[model samples]
Target: MSQSFSLRTKSFLAGLVLPLLLGACESSVSVRGNFPDPEEVSSLEKGVHTRRDVADRLGSPSTLSTFQDQVWYYIGEKVEKTAFYDPVVLDRTVLIVKFSSDGMLEESHAYALEDGRVIDPVTRETPTEGQDLTIIQQLLGNLGKFNPGGNK
Candidate 1:
């Protein structure tokens, strides 16, 4: 009888612990973008590595400079998310590779999450030269526009 009770207790404990263990495994982590390895980054020799060499070594950059193409940006981000919660950024890397006018690598810079800054975007709306109509107004305006005769 004791042996049966012990088996039943172990089974009951395992049933409770299994769900908790599964629940704890809900966290999902994801890494996005082609982040270059440290060795690949180190292989770049300033002034010797041209645009082509850099591209061949590290792959195409995530993006180029906004206005000028002299600077290349390789961005990578790691995020973690769990059930019903907002994703949290676990890591972020922004590799800035600058080139001279002759297309030779001038310098390289790496920035991490701590180096980032938050900028509040401008919220003011740009007024356009058009009347804003309601849903009913839009529906009524479109009603007569289509010909019921199916004219081509």
Candidate 2:
């Protein structure tokens, strides 16, 4: 009788713990952006391929240069996330395709995750030419400013 109870308890504990362990090990993978195939990217030739041909092959770029339309960026990333944990980037690819003024491919470069750099943004606030008022002061300041009459 004692041995049977011990075995039953062990099985119950395993049934509860096994699923938790599996759940913790499970991670969801998310792929975002148009990650072009290696064959498609290799098909593009510098100075030979035009923007229309490249666009037709690889589709529209993820984003164009902020100031100009000459540079195109095809950015892609794969992220894995587990329950209650920050997402981890498994892979990142940035394909930069530069075009000349005449719309021909000038140069192309592919950057992987290892070639990327992390930039910390500046947090300093810019001084503005205005007086900062508190909520209470703002409410009290407007109390007497209201003109009840229809006249301005």
Candidate 3:
């Protein structure tokens, strides 16, 4: 009888603990964009390496300059999330490569996660002209105003 009781207690404890362990272990990681190696980037020479050479060494850029085609940007970021919380940025890197009009590498710059500044997003809500109605008010608001389809 004691053996059976011990087995039942163990099984009950296992069933309760298993789900909590699994729920607490939930997490996700996301990586975006290609990050170039420092050694490879150093190999590129200003006013010497062409666009093709840069592309071959660093891979295609994540984006080109918004206002000009002479600049290229390589962006990389890693984000992580646990359970139901918002994702947090774990790492971020931005490499800017500028080319001369003749397509030679002019300059390169790298920005790390610590080099960035945080900007709070705009959260002000725009107010519109309307009466805030409750569920019952909304449901009954148009009940008597509906005109049955006779063209009047």
lDDT at residue 94 of model 2 (Cα atoms): 95
Tell me the whole-model lDDT of each prediction, alpha carbons only: 0.94, 0.94, 0.93
Candidate 1 local lDDT, 1-152, one digit each (tens):
99999999999999999999889869999999868987999989999999999999999999999999899999999999998789999999999999999999999999999999999999999899989999999989997787898967
Which candidate number would show the highest TM-score if scored against the true structure?
Answer: 3
Give the clashing pairs for model 3: none
TM-score of 3: 0.75
Cα-based TM-score, every candidate: 0.65, 0.69, 0.75
Q: In model 2, what lDDT does residue 53 have?
A: 89
- Residue-wise C-alpha lDDT for candidate 2, range 22-86, written one tens digit per residue: 98879999999979888999989989999998999989999999998899999999999998889
Report the CA-based lDDT of candidate 1 relative to the real structure: 0.94
